[model samples]
Each structure stands twice: as structure tokens, then as C-alpha cells.
Target chain A: DQQVKQNSPSLSVQEGRISILNCDYTNSMFDYFLWYKKYPAEGPTFLISISSIKDKNEDGRFTVFLNKSAKHLSLHIVPSQPGDSAVYFCAAQLKYNFNKFYFGSGTKLNVKP
Target chain B: DVKVTQSSRYLVKRTGEKVFLECVQDMDHENMFWYRQDPGLGLRLIYFSYDVKMKEKGDIPEGYSVSREKKERFSLILESASTNQTSMYLCASSPGGGFNEKLFFGSGTQLSVL
Candidate 1:
């Protein structure tokens, strides 16, 4: 069973526009949600994260919002750039098991200039 | 900065061959993980270790085994390679303080089995 799911396999957006990538999870025990960005021939790198206690967290142009009641979260990038084109993965970490994380099938984001 | 290094960037192995993929971390992290990335499948954990000589099976550990003799190094072994096992293997490490620490990943090794 996939604990985390990214329904859209791909997303395309124009540069200088807002881009939103959605993710859903089935488990309520997850206390922390994170996003990772990966480029071709490279491993994923951490982007931003939000704790369950907070509904939203922002880091410069990258912001993450969590909705516990719906078991869903979304990452919003303001003024998307061409360099932001890559695969974005949503991950959830169990409250007790900090060492283990569940990841969703990534959504490939293409920013067209 | 924490650096996780996979021994090889690309490897090609034939079926029935015994394969070993090596990973080393410079941060002396207590937790290490091995995950495989496949198309539309995301990153699935194969195995993880919390300490030296200790390991735990992840969601997909059927055809794979892991060894962590030291805190800085983790190895993934394929007893018998198969075509189905071909994919990108990634190694990651994180500190072990029970905190929500982000995982530092290696560049990944693309293993192709013929």
C-alpha cells in the first residue's frame, strides 16, 4: 500500500507564474511532511518541510501547506523559474519512527520560459 | 556539509552474478538507508541500518541484503542478479537523535542487469 500518493504524474507551468503540486497521504500518524527536488542523474535534495503542528511553512519563494483534516499537502512555488524544472517528491515521516519515511510517486514539473 | 558517496555512478552486471554496491557517508551518521527509484514507483526503501552491524528490512527487501560493518559505510548485496532488479539505487544518511532530520543522499548508482 502506498501511504503517500501524488495523483498527477506531471505538471507544466509558464515561467513567472505560480506552480502548485499536490500530494495526499493515507496515514494520520505522520507528523512531519517534506518535499524533495531531484534532477536528472542526481539524487534528491531536501527542499522544504512543515510540521503537523503548523498549517504552513514558507522558505523564500518555496512554501508548503498542510491540511491535516484532509490528509493532504501542497507545495507552492511563486514565480516559477526554468531552473526549477525537476521531479518533486512528497514524503511523510512517522511520529514515532523518525528514521523511516514514506515517499510518493514524483510529479515531474516543467517550467517553460 | 554531509556527503554520501556511492562507489560507482553506473554499473552493469549480468544475470546470476553476485553484485555489491557500496556507499559511504562522511558525517558519521547513525542511520543509513538504501532505496531504489523506478519509473512511476517513487523511492522504495530496500533496507536501513540504525547502527553498526544492525539492519532492518524496508518495504522491498526480497532480493536484496545489506551490510553495515561501520557507521560510515553501508553495502547492498544482490545474491543473484536478475533483470527485474535493474534500477537506480540511492543511499542516504541522517543523524540519529530522534529528530526530524533531513536525509542526505548520494548521487546514486544506475545498475543495469543483463
Candidate 2:
């Protein structure tokens, strides 16, 4: 069973528009959520993260929202650019198990310029 | 910046051959992991090591083995490579004793079993 799920396989948005990627988790034990971005021929890089204690966390143009009640989280990018097109993965971790992480299948975001 | 390095960017091995993928980290982190990425299945954890000579199996460890004789190096071994095992292999490292520590990943090694 997949603890983390990104139902959307792909997303398309126009440049300078808002792009939102969604993820859901089944396990309530997960207390931390993170987003990673991967480009062609490269490993994934950390984007942003949010703790379960807070509802939202923002960094520059990226914002991560966590809804503990629904076991859902989302990544929002404002004014999306062409360079932002890549595979985005949502990951979660249980507070007790810091070494293990659960990752989603990933969503490919395409920004049209 | 923490750097995780995988030995090869691409590898081709014959079926039933023994394959070894090497990974090393420069950050002196205590945790290392091996994962394989498939098109639709995403990333599946194969194995992880928290300390020298200690390893644990992850979500998917079948047909795979790991070795961590030293603190900075971790190796994934395929006892008998099969065509189905052909995928992108990634190595990651993270510091110990932290809650939700970020993982530093290598460039990944694409292994093809013919």
C-alpha cells in the first residue's frame, strides 16, 4: 500500500499563472511533508517543506500547505516559469522514524510559455 | 553543500550477471539509502544503512543486497541481474538525529540489464 499518493500524473499551466500540485497520505503518523523537484538527467532537489503543526509554509515563490484533517498537502508556485517544468514528488516522514521516508509516484508539471 | 556520488551514470549488464553499484557521500552523514525509480511506479526503497556494517531492508529488497563496510560508502548488489531490474538507481544521504532531515541525492545511475 502506498502511504503517499499523488493522484495527478501530470499537470499543465501557462506561464505567469499559479500552479498547484496536490498529494494525499493515508497514515496520520506522518508529521512532516516535503516537496522535491527533478529535472531531466538530474537527481531531485529539495523545494519546500511544511510541518504538521502549521497549515502553511512559504519560500519565495513556493508555498506548501498541509491540511492535517484531510491528510492532504499541496505545493503552490506563483508566476510559474518555463524553467519550473519538471517532475515534482511529495514525500512524508513519521516523526518517530527519521531515517525512513515515503514518497509519492510524482507529478510531471509542464509550463507553457 | 552535501554531495552524494554514484559511481556510474549508466551501466549495462548481461542477464544473470552479478552487478555492483557503488555510492559514496562526502557529507559524513550517518544514513544512506538505495532506491530504484521506474516510470509509473515511482521510487521504491531497496535498502538503507544507518551505521557502518549495519543495514536494513526497505519497501522492496528482493533480488538485492547492500554492503556498508565503511561509514561513507554504500553498495547495492544484484545477485543475478534480470531485465526487469533495469531502471534508474539513486543513492541518498541524510544526517542523523534530526526530525525530517532533508536528503541529499546523487545524480543517479541508469542500469540496463540486457
Candidate 3:
């Protein structure tokens, strides 16, 4: 069973516009959520993360929001740049079991220049 | 900075042949992981190790096995190569098994089983 799901397989947005990627999860035991950005033929790099205690976390142009009640989270990039185009993956981790993580299928984001 | 390195960028093997994919980390991380990434399927964990000589099966460990003889290296083995095992393999490592620690990943090894 897929505990984490990214319903949208792809998204396209113009540069300097806001790009929103959504993810949903069915497991309430997950207490920490993270987003990673991956380019072609490269390993995924950590973007930003939010703890269950906090509803929102922001880092420069990247921001992550979590809604515990709905088991939903989103990664938003403001003024998206062409360099930001890549596959975005959302992952969840259990507080007690820190080593194991569950990842979503991923959403390919294309920022048009 | 933590660096996880996969021995090869690409590899090819024939059916019934034994294959080994090696991964090494510069940081003395206590936890190491092997994941397979496929188109549209995202990343699936094959195996993970918490410490030297210790390993745990992840969600899809059916055709794979792993070893961690040293603190800095982890190896994934395919006893008998099968076409279904063709995919991109990624290795990751994280500092102590602490809560909220992020993972550092290798570039990945694209393996093809013919």
C-alpha cells in the first residue's frame, strides 16, 4: 500500500510565478515530513522539512506547509525559476523510527523560462 | 559535507549472473540505505543497515541482499540477475540514527539486467 501519494504526476508554471505541488498521506504515525528536489541523473537533495508540531516552515524561495488533520502537505516555490524545474518528492518519517522513510511517487515540476 | 559514492554510474549483467553494487560514504554514519528508483514509482527501499554487519529488509527485498562489513561501506547483491531487477539504485547515509536528521544520497547506479 502507498502510504504517501502525489496525485499529480506533473505541473507546469511560468517563471516568477508561484508553483504549488501537493502531497497526501494516510499514515498518522508520521511525525516529520520532508521535500527533496532531484534533477536528471543526479541524487535528490534535501529542500525543506516541517515537524508535525509546526504547520509551516519556510526557507528562502521554498516553503512547506503541513495539515495534520487532513494528512496533507504542500511545497510552494515563490517566483519559480527555470532552474527549479525538476522532480519533487515528498517523504514522511516516524518519530520513533527515524531510519525508515516513506516517499511519494513524485511530481515533475516544469518552470518555463 | 557527507558524501555517498556508488562504485559505478552504469552496469550491465546477464540473467543468472551474480551482481554486486557497492556504496561508500565519507561520513561515519551509523545508518545506510539502498533504494531503487523507477519511472513513476519513485524510490523504494531495498535494504538498510544501522551499524556494521547489521542489516534490515526494506519494503522490497525479495531479490536483493545487502552487507555492511565496515562503517563506511554498504553493498547490495543480486544473487541471480533478472530482467525485472533493471533499475536505478541509490545509496544514502545519515549521521547518527537521530530524529529529524536528513539523508545524503549518492549520484546513483543504473543497472541493467539482460
Candidate 4:
């Protein structure tokens, strides 16, 4: 069973627009959510994260929103740039597992300039 | 910046060959992991080590084995390489096995089994 799921396989957005990537988890025990970005032949890099205690966390142009009630989290990239065009993965971890991440299928975001 | 290094960026192995992928961390982290990423399937965990000389199987441990000889190094071994084993392998390390701890990842190794 997939604990974390990213239903959208791909998304296209115009530059300078808002790009939102969504992720859902089934296990209620998962209290930490993270986002990672990956390019071709490269390993994933940390983007942003949100704890279950808070509803939202923002860093520069990136914001992560966690809705504990729905077991859902979303990553918002404002004023999206061409450089942001890549595969984005939503990962989750239970309170017990720590940095052990459970990843989703990932969403390929294409920003049209 | 914490650096996680994988021994190779690319590797080629023949069927039935024993292949070893090595990962090392310089941050004195207590946790290390190995994952394989495939197209459309995302990243799947192969194994993880929480301490020196201790290892645990992750979601997908079949046909694979892991070793943590030292605190900074984690190794993944493929007993027999197959075409299905061709994928990008990633290694990561964290200071502790906490949910909020950030993982430092290596550049990844692309292993091709023919």
C-alpha cells in the first residue's frame, strides 16, 4: 500500500504564475511532510517541509501547507521560474521513523516561458 | 554543508555479476540510506542503516543486501545483477533518524545491468 500518493503525474504552468503540487498520505501517524526536487540524473534535493503542528510553512518563494485533517499537503511555488521546471516529490515520515522518507510518484512541472 | 559521496556516477555490470555500490558520509551522521529511482515509479528504499555495523531492510530489499562496516559508510550489494536492476541509485545521510532532520544526498550513481 502506498502511504504517500501524488495523483498528478505532470503539470504545466506559465512563468511568474503560481504552481501548486499536491500530496496525500494514508497513515495518520505521519506527522512530517517534505518536498524534494530532482533533475535528470541527479539525486533529490530538499525544498521545503512542514510539521503537523502548523498549517503552513514558507521559505522565500516556496510555501508548504499541511492539512492534518485531510492528511494532505501541498507545495506552492510563487512566481514560478523556468529553473523550477523539474520533477517534484512529496515525502512523508512518521513520528517514529525520523529522516526515513516515504516518497510519492512525483509530479513533473513544466514552466512555459 | 554535509556531503554524501557515492563511489561512482555510472556503473555497468553483466548478468549474474556481483555488484557493490558504496556510499560514504562526512557529516558523522547516524543514519544512512540507499534508494533506487525508476521512471514513473519514483524512489523506492533499498535499505537503511541507523548505526555502525547495523542495517535494516527498507520497502524493497529483495535481491539486495546492505552493510554498515563503519559509521560513515553504507554499502548496497546486488547478489546478481539483472536488467531490472538498472536504475539511478541514491545515498543519503542525516544527523539522526528524526522526522524533521534533513537528509544530505549524494549526486547518485546510475547502474546499468546488461
Candidate 5:
């Protein structure tokens, strides 16, 4: 069973608009969530992360909101640029198992200019 | 920057043949991982090592094995390659085995089995 799920396979947005991606997890033990961005033929890179203790975490144009009650998290990019087009993956780690991570299928984001 | 380098970007192997995929990291990280990326399946961990000569199985380690004789190096071994094993293999490294540590990944190695 997939502990983490990104239901949206793809998303499209216009440049300078707000792009939002959503993710849900089934494991209540997961205390940390992370977002990774990947381009074609390239490995994924860390984007942003949030801890269960915090409701929101922001870095520059990126913001991650966590709702522990719903077991959901979302990533928002303000003024989305064409360069931001890539596959976004949401991953979660169990609080006790630090070495193992569970990843979602990923959503392909297309920011149109 | 943390540079995790895979020895090969692409490889073609015959079924039943033994295959070895090598990975090296510039950072002196204590944790290394092997994962396979497939459409719909996302990235599934095959194996990981916390330190030299130490290894552990991940979610999908049925036909795969890993070796970590050195701290900076981790190798994934396919004892008997099969067509089903064809996929993008990724190697990653982290400073420590912690939920807070963000992973650094290699570009990836696409292995094709005939």
C-alpha cells in the first residue's frame, strides 16, 4: 500500500500565477514531509520540507502547508515561472524509521509562459 | 554541492547475466541508497547502507543486492538480470540516517535488459 499519494498526475498553470500541488498520506506516524523537483533525464532535488510541529514553512517563492488532522500537505509557488515546469514528488518519513522513506507517484507540473 | 556519480548512464544486459551498477559520492556521507524509478510506481527503494560493509533491504529487494565495502561507494548487484529489471536506477546519499536529512541523488542509470 502507498502510504503517500499524489492524486494529481499532472497540473498546468499560467506564468505569474499561483500553482498549488497537493499530497496526502495514510501513515499517522509520518512526522516529516518533503518535496522534490525533477526534470527530464535528471535526478530529483530537494525543494522544501515541513515538520509536523509547524503548520506552514516558506522559502522564497515556495510555501508548504501541513494539516496534521487531514494528513495532507500542499506546495504553493507564487508567480510560477516556465522554468518551474517539472515533476514534483512528495515524500514522507516515519517518525521512528529515519532511514526509510516513502514517495508518491509524482505530479508533472507545466507552467506555461 | 553534493555530487553523487553513477558509473554508467546507460547499460544493456542480457537476461541471466550478472550486472553491477556502481555509485560514488563526493560527500563523506554515512548513508547511501539504491532506488528504481518507474512510471506510476514512483521511486521505490531497493536497498541502502548506513556505513561501510553494512547494508539493509528496502521495500523492493527481491532480485537485487547491494554492497558497500567503502564509505563513499555503494554498488547494486543484479545476480540474474531479467526484462522486468529494466528501469532507471538512482543512487542517493545523506549525511546521516535521519528523517530530517535531505538526500542528494545521482543523475541516474538506465538499465535495459534484453
Candidate 6:
């Protein structure tokens, strides 16, 4: 079973537009959520994360919104740039400690210039 | 900054042969993990080691084993290569075992088994 699911396999957006990617989880115990970005041949890299205690976390042009009641999270990039094109994965952390992470299939985002 | 380095970016192996994939980290992370990435399956963990010589099987450890002799090194072993094992193998390291710790990944090793 997929504890975390990104439903959307791919998404495309125009430059300078808002690009939103969504993720959902079934496990309520997952308190910490993280986002990673991967290029075609590169490994994933940390993007942003949020704790269950907070509803939203923002860094620069990226913002992650957490809906605990809905068990859903979304990443928003304002003014999406062509360079932002990559596969985005959402992962969840069960315990506050230890590196047990569950990942989603990933959403491929394409930004058109 | 944490840096994870995989020994190979691309490899080709013959069926029934043995394969060893190596990973090294410069951050002295205590936790290291191995995962395979395939289309539709995403990234599934193969094995992980919290400390030297300690290993735990992850979701997909059927055809793989792991060895950790030093704090900075982790190795994934494929006892008998098979066509099904051809995929991108990724190695990651975290400062600690806590899920809160950010993971640093190597470039990845793409293996092709014939």
C-alpha cells in the first residue's frame, strides 16, 4: 500500500505563474513532511519541510501548506521558472526521531518559458 | 555541507555475477541507507545501517545485502545479478537516525544486468 501518494504524475505551468503540487498521506502518525527535487539523472535533494504543528512553511519562493484534517500537503512555487523543472517527491517522517521515511511516486513538473 | 558519493554512476553486470556498489559520505553521518528507484515504484529502500556493522532490511531487500565497516562507508551487495535488478541505485546519508534529519544523496549508480 502506498502510505503517501502524489496522484498527479506530471504537471506543467507557464513561467511566472503559480505552480502547485499536491500530496496525500494515509498515516496520521506522520508529523513531519519533506519535499525533495530530482532531475533526470541526479539524486533527490531537500527542498522544504513542515511540521504537523504548523499549517504552513515558506522559504523564498516556495511554500508548503499542511492540512492535517485532510491529511494532505501541497507545494507552491510563485513565479515558477524554467529552471524549476524537475520531479518533486513528498516524504513523511513517522517518528520525530530516526530516519524512517516514506516516499510518494513523485510529480514531474515542467515549466514552460 | 553533507556530501554523499557513490563509487559508480553507471555499471553493467552479467547474470549470475556478483556486484558491489559502494558509497561514501564526508559528513560522518551515523545513518546510511540504500534504495532503488524504478518507474512506478518510486524509491524503495533496500537496507539501512544506523551504526557500523549494524544493518536492517528495508522494504525491498530480497536480492540485496549491506555491509558497513566504517562510519563513513556503506556497501550494497548483489549476490547474484539478475535482469530484474537492473535499475538506479541510490545511496543516502543522514546525520542521525531521526526522520527529522535531512538526507544527502549520492549522484546514483545505474546498473544494467544482462
The model with the greatest lDDT is 1
Per-residue CA lDDT of model 4 for A1-113, tens digit only, reads 87899999999999999999999999999878889999887778999998899999999999999998898999999999999999999988888867568899899999999
**DockQ for all models, in order?**
0.84, 0.79, 0.82, 0.70, 0.77, 0.71
Q: Write the per-residue lDDT of candidate 3 for residues A39-61, one digit (tens) a residue.
A: 98888999999999999999999
**TM-score result, candidate 6:** 0.98
Error of 5 at A18 (Å): 1.0
- Candidate 6 pairs with clashing backbones: A97-B98, A98-B97, A98-B98, A98-B99, A99-B97
How many clashes (backbone atoms < 3 Å, residues ≥3 apart in a chain or on different chains) does model 6 have?
A: 5
- Weakest 10 consecutive residues of candidate 4 chain A by summed lDDT: A92-101
Model 1 Cα lDDT, one tens digit per residue, B13-107:
99999999999999989999999999999999999999999999999999999999989999999999999999999999999878578898999
lDDT of 5 at B7: 95
Q: Quote the lDDT for A10 in model 1.
A: 99
TM-score of chain B of 1: 0.98
For all candidates, what are the clash counts? Answer: 0, 0, 0, 2, 0, 5
Q: Tens-digit lDDT track for model 6 on B21-88?
A: 99999988899999999887778889999999998989889989999999999999999999999999
Recovered native contacts, candidate 3: 0.74
Two-way TM-score contest, 5 vs 6, winner: 5
Scored against the true structure, residue A7 in model 6 reaches a CA lDDT of: 94
- Candidate 1 has an fnat equal to 0.74
lDDT of 2: 0.94
Compose the digit string of candidate 6's lDDT tens values, residues A6-108.
9999999999999999999999999899999999889999999998999999999999999999999999999899999999999998865466788999999
Ranked by TM-score, the better of candidates 3 and 6 is 3
- In the order shown, the candidates' Cα RMSDs to the true structure are 0.6, 0.7, 0.7, 1.1, 0.8, 1.0
Q: For residues B17-101, what per-residue lDDT tens digits would candidate 5 score against the true structure?
A: 9999999999899999999999988999999999999999999999999999999999999999999999999999999855687
State, as a TM-score between 0 and 1, how close model 4 is to the true structure: 0.97
- How would the docking of model 3 be graded? high
Question: What's the lDDT for all of these models?
Answer: 0.97, 0.94, 0.95, 0.91, 0.95, 0.93
Tens-digit lDDT track of model 2 for B1-114: 999999999999999999999999998999999999998777789999999999999999999999999999999999999999999999999998799698888999999999
